[model samples]
Target: MHRLLVVLCISVALVAGAEQDVLELTDDNFNSVLKQHETTLVMFYAPWCGHCKRLKPEYAKAAELVKGDDPPIALAKVDCTEAGKETCGKFSVSGYPTLKIFRGDSVSQDYSGPREANGIVKYMRAQVGPASRNIKSIDEINKFLDTKDTTIFGFFEDPDVALAKLFVKFADKNREKYRFGHSNDPDVLAKYGETEKIVLFRAPHLANKFEETNVQFEGSSESELSTFVKENFHGLVGHRTQDTIRDFKNPLIVAYYSVDYVKNPKGTNYWRNRVLKVAKEFTNKATFAISAKDDFQHELNEYGYDFVGDKPVILARDEKNLKYALKEEFSVENLRDFVEKLLDGELEPYVKSEPIPENNNAPVKVAVAKNFDEVVINNNKDTLVEFYAPWCGHCKKLAPVFDEVAEKLENEEVDLVKMDATANDVPPEFNVRGFPTLFWLPKNQKDKPVAYNEGREVDDFIKYIAKHATNELNGFDRSGKSKKTEL
Candidate 1:
């Protein structure tokens, strides 16, 4: 019976491993297969990793699509623990499921593109051809210009010159972000300029009353082209979506609203026009953009706000990445005032807090956003506060031990406090890098909070308090013990 059961388990494992759509490679065939294909995307993963498990089905779906393409973009995987450990180490892969694109003669680049099936398929298709497409005539130039994304065209009479080579190199690095094409036709080159000129044409839907529709560049380096494209890609009030948020440079002011281009285009522009009015006044002071409220709801929730009616939400960030919120209702006047104050460094940032507890004098005092100043910052007694995330496993283990210490020192001269770091905003002076971060706020020097890195036992807390407390304790000794009152 034992032999029969072992045989059944082995059979099931073999069946599951054979069903993978992606080709499995080891050190022996890895380089051979990479050299065989024009473009191959490889995922280096381990079987026991949770993230790799979740990505298994998504990768399988993408592999099926890429294998059917004209040039056949090979989707392959290397099991680092099974038979490919040496291959993973050679590539310096330190994480599970690291993706890299291998083009035959070119240097391999990391694949930071999307993870979903359709998005990966689209991204890989873009990599199948040359970095920039070759436009043979005026007809092909007009066809290539018809795209939803901003397009760049380099008109050169000769394709083997230095400028053409530089343009292709830049496009090779940024082709995932924008469209690039080059034309050598005399008819097409005559329209722009006979000289070699790079022209950036803005998207039609991105047109506005502010900023030019197109711009020509005479720069010599790739960095200058990057700067020119970034500065001129979007109009005055940039049409920002979730995918393009990282492109907008700070200090940035973003307007979040119910913007639907297909369902209600007029309403989207109505608010965009209002934001443009304020954007023009602060020109060059900061970058301005608008994002869809529903799409941006998760991030706004971190700022402690919910989706209220159609009234738009306004938020700004400084160069330091400190966030500022607008409290008043959305209006041209209110928005303009908020921008002026934010740029002038006068607006108070929004503080996120839960409702203060009705009675916080328990053994372990609770510190919240509303009472942080009263309980931890401005209090006269020494405070040992724990900033913790509720979902953290380490914090859950320390909860009962912390309660015991607080009860043991109920009559002492210090306060034992805990705050939910997720639900409340911490001050800038204290940095909480991980869960269950503890800090000691000594008396009179309330501004300076010393970080606590001692043990987590009841004795550890008591001893730390005894040595760091500003006022001597009445009920405890230096060794963290109860004082004797025998006479």
Candidate 2:
């Protein structure tokens, strides 16, 4: 009995270890496996990618769920960094954890649905047939609506219609979120009380008794259909990942509130409800999204907002990558005012990575984005500017030397300035590509900023400035003493 118990424990352990039912494919056998499996889902991943690591368990669970289907759907993975580099390259896998579906040797489609076990399984099952189902009877249409959370039905007069084909393509991309079916039957069309050639029906939830809400497309253009679906279907946008955030496009306003939906549901609702009220006011102008503090710390840092503070932070980004933070408290009135200022171009954008100086006492006057045009562009004195990033080690090393150079040239006509390139946007003509990049902007010749390629020592800077300056060097000597002649 003891031996039998030990054997049973070992068998359970083995089964648990074998839970990863996904097939591992190499460059050699990838083509052969694709040839054998009629429908296969391939994931191109890298070991170092965090997203790929998170997707592994979910993909394995999906694999286990669909391993015994009628034609047996196959889930395969290839490590792009290793033996599968060629295979991944052939598929143009630019990003890690790219999923592609293969239907025999002739067809391949990029999978762009939700990255969850159940979502993946549902999408793969849908891909086994045509993107949109053909409903024959009213009972079939009702049954289909009952199964899906959201169902879109296209009632077409004929099977080979243009709108029907467009609806199928749209459904194929969004199968994870919506179910699509088309009916040419007069009985099915009559049940929905539609006479138009193309009509879209949005079936309500099962809890709501599947009440069908629909709209008719008057125009046959794809853009008209797409706009109708986008405007009506996407009720609210919630950003959970970076990919979803990017989908919102530029000129997006995201509310980074501290509320745990799982732990403190009330707090979450209170925060989101406040943002939702403001979101509704400007829905047509900008995309409004709510992001939990923990899930969006990286984005917060990128936009130069603090997520570890007491109050929630609101941030907006334009198409040009310019970021703005709302200084006012989280209220509907304050948010509305903030958005108004943003749209009116009254708000000042700032870079988070730049260091704010304590004072301008040092010889090098710190230039920031706010005063960049005033200090550097409008100044009458010839300016030697050092564009440096705070995190650069080489820039740190040169700080003292730059300060000394600034002191030596203080009495002269030239002004030595330092600007944090990471935080400030220099003029386009400056072209600061690297850290500790120096440029000499002549007094009246502001448009022609000359790049400094000489050594980083004080002597090298002094010589370079003296050589290029329009005025004579008066108060300083090369050996750090008062002189009459040019150093």
Question: Model 2 shows how many backbone clashes?
Answer: 0
Give the alpha carbon lDDT tens digit for every residue of 19-84 in model 2. 567878899988887788889999999999999989887788888888887546888899999999
Evaluated at residue 326, the lDDT of candidate 2 is 88
Deviation in angstroms for 56 in model 1?
A: 10
Clash pairs, candidate 1, are none
Candidate maximizing TM-score: 1
Worst lDDT run of 10 residues, candidate 1, spans 12-21
Task: State TM-scores per candidate.
Answer: 0.69, 0.59
Predictions: Cα RMSD each: 8.7, 8.6
Worst 10 residues of 2 by lDDT: 203-212
**What residue runs in model 2 are displaced by over 4 Å at the alpha carbon?**
1-21, 26-36, 44-73, 79-129, 135-153, 160-180, 185-188, 197-216, 229-233, 236-241, 247-251, 257-274, 302-313, 317-355, 358-371, 374-487
